[model samples]
Target: MTDQVATTEAPEDWEPSEVQRERNEWRRRRTLRSAVIAAGSTLLLLGIIGGLVVSSPGWERVQATYFDWDKAVSSFPAVLEGLWLNIRVMALCAVLIVALSLTIAVMRTIRGPVAFPLRLVGTAYVDIFRGLPLLLVIFLLGFGGPALSLQGLPTSALFWGCSALVLSYSAYVAEVFRAGIESVHPSQRLAGRSLGLTYGQTLRHVVLPQAWRRVIPPLMNDLVSLQKDSGLIAVLGVVDAIRAAQIQTAIDFNYTPYVVAGFLFCCLTIPMARLTDRYARKKGYHGAGGHL
Candidate 1:
């Protein structure tokens, strides 16, 4: 009984060493100090900006030109139409990107004789598009389409914008897909094979589904980026939200329409950002073996 008691007590008395405890305490204090300093700096900057805005003479003119509701409302219909075009472009681009990215990702992951060349092609595509700016991609698609003699392509401003978006975004999505695929554990693949599943069958049934869930947050981030990048299409003379706003402001010589357009973009993006955060939290909790 004495031996049993000693054994039990031994485990209970195993505290951290004093030096380790002191180090941990120091880390905690350092973190707290840095957080306070950051917060104080942010508040100081805001106060300075507030003082400047209150004292500035041009504040009223700036507000009138950019923030007047009546002028913004008068341009509502055109803005709504432009927003619809933006949505259509985003949807089409997302579909094409997902399909292309998945195909290239699969090619890159496959083992055997075919993998090398396929990966090379996929790498080249990703490198080229990612290295070039989105604006350049849009301009090339819009202005160079006819030169390439591509047939059955839409000549409408919206079509050109959508094509450019798909081309540019597919490269980015492909890399996201490759990363997700590579993150899947090799043991998972071996287990599936041991259970008599073919390589393709295991990938389809076991791997891709898990990889896709893990990739949702990054993909959602990319989607948000594509939403903002859609504005770049305006350079192609596409009548998207930004272009429509610019046209209205140009004619009226008031910046109110531009403000309305900015608000519209924010309205579209903020909800998506919230949704992505919620989903990411849920995924993290699920992964942690916590209740959803």
Candidate 2:
């Protein structure tokens, strides 16, 4: 007994208790039940409405408007051309918006007396753009361009449309950039400073890369919104998708072409929405591990 050595016990790994496990299972079941109920209710409502619509005389009118194959096919090429214009406007605007947004975001993030004025200007820009309707903005830009001495700068309807879009969307995108910058932790900033990097260097080389990754989903969503908003350029008589549809409608004296246009818009938006959702899921998964 005198020669016996003391034995130390190792710490056991922590595990969930039975009660905790039951609680988690219950929560999971509750979430599943709610989702199922929502899906069932939606399907039931859709079924009821579909049955009623199919049985009604007005169903024929709806079908004629939405499913007139001849009219839709006849207008298809013009609609496709308009669709191309929409794509061009969106792409150009996206480039300009990204550049402007980055500059504004960086200015706003700079701390000190210099930062306040820049931030104020950025805020004003965002407020003005976001407050106005998209249609109004397009009209102003399109019609006012000559007055503003900007008409001859580009001259084309596509140029005017892109100009308006970039002006409006840049403001919104700036906020996204700002939010991404703000999301980077102060500790990380401090760590960068401790590593002898200057503020700008740290932001440029370290923080912004992470922030860009975090902000991708929202940026994608904004791009999708911008795509839809491009249609507003039609108010400028730019012969965009909506305008093409209107022209077809007038020529054929049928509402079917308008329905076709609506379908085209859905075609444009749906893919972008799906892409955004995928990006959001990927972002969430990456974020779950805690700080960047």
| Tens digit of per-residue lDDT, candidate 2, span 184-275 | 99888899999999988899888899899988888888988888888888877889888998899888577777787788888988888777
lDDT of every model, 2 decimals: 0.84, 0.83
C-alpha root-mean-square deviation, candidate 2: 7.0
TM-score of 2: 0.79
**Which has the greatest lDDT?**
1
Backbone atom clashes (below 3 Å) for every candidate: 0, 0
Least lDDT summed over 10 consecutive residues: which range in candidate 1?
A: 283-292
TM-score of each: 0.79, 0.79
Task: Report the C-alpha displacement of residue 49, candidate 1, in angstroms.
Answer: 4.2
True lDDT of residue 270, candidate 2: 82
Cα deviation of 101, candidate 1, in Å? 0.9
